[model samples]
Target: MPLYKEIVCNENAKLYLWKITEEIEFFKHAVLLKDVSQKRVDAMKSESHQKGFLAVRMLLQHVGYTDFDLYYDAFGKPHLSDGKCISISHSHTFSAIAISDQPIGLDVEQVKEKVLKIASRFMDVSHLENLSDAEKMKKATVIWGIKESIFKIKNETGISFPKHIFEEEFNLESKKTIAQLQFNAKTENFNVVFDSVEEYIYVCAFEVDPNFLQ
Candidate 1:
């Protein structure tokens, strides 16, 4: 199978994208299979999940981790034995993973019109205003990705939408944005970067620290 492009961010995070060209057998060997159910196992036959698993495994190996033991926390967030923070996402035919020394989040979405229907659920007035006519559809998906990343970092579920968690708008020319998470009455902000590939967009956000993996 051919691997898609891999990007290393300035904050010591590694992102890997994999193009789905192999059969389902590739997923059977994934490190994430420990607690997965037969139904989830059957679901991996879908190309998107397979590619996502491949990307995640690649990042796990790159970070000097082997032995695929993934378990969900009380809130349903995936956790690893090592303290390394990790996140995984998948779009139609592409999957991506992000790993860093600090907690991190990553998301991948296929550009689709359905994202527009639920924009209000996750976006605020200012975020909506910043989007242009051509970008309106994509804006919600991006927001969803940002929120997913935040949830992974926090390892908490049931967080509210953009009103509770805010992301600063940046021009498309600028590939990065800042987001703030307010939960349990405390707030913390972090930087997030995004990139556009063939038919999908990928996003990654994490805490800022100098000691990220080089």
Candidate 2:
């Protein structure tokens, strides 16, 4: 498929997603990769991984960027030449990137039963209370994405999902939530939005503005 979806996280950030239905060649032919990205893709051992990698470039091109405009820091956080804060994520058959004037992070994951199995390891299982089996799986995936999105925004060492991040209890229908991160003697809050496309759950996160929408 082409671009799967776009998210307006806030006035300052936008997110793009790609569904990896086409073969790897689709991405190779559609997007121009700088040499480093070409070399990285060449070394990928899995075609799905290569497609996922290239799919990101496809998204970059979708947003007027190329591999040439993206770079990584020592900690491997992605930066754009124009100084926009950018975050990238892909899982299974989906890939996503968030571009923001402010710091942001995005994540996508296939909805799978396995997330429920390990839900307790990373999120507050109490929030899963009251949902049926199917809802449990979906909610668990959302919570995991919330934590992962927040972690990517923070991008700091020693920030364990189970130890430092917490999602406020929320009804699934809300489609958005507030989460907090407690690390290094500080507490920071984030605003998160999540939704499902086909069988995948995608998340986008931004630091909460003091006047954030209630």
lDDT score, candidate 2, position 162:
95
Cα lDDT tens digits, model 1, 60-150, are: 5655664364445777666667766667777767866676777788888887877777777777745657567557656666777778777
Scored by lDDT, the top model is: 2
TM-score of 2: 0.96
Model 2, which residues run further than 4 Å from truth?
none
Model 1 segments more than 4 A misplaced: 26-51, 58-64, 67-71, 130-132, 209-214
Instruction: Pick out the ten consecutive residues of candidate 1 with the lowest summed lDDT.
Output: 30-39
For candidate 1, give the lDDT. Answer: 0.69
lDDT of 2 by residue, 10-110 (tens): 89999898888998777889888888888999999999899889999889988998899999998889999999999999898888899999989888888
TM-score of each: 0.80, 0.96
Clashes in predicted model 1:
0
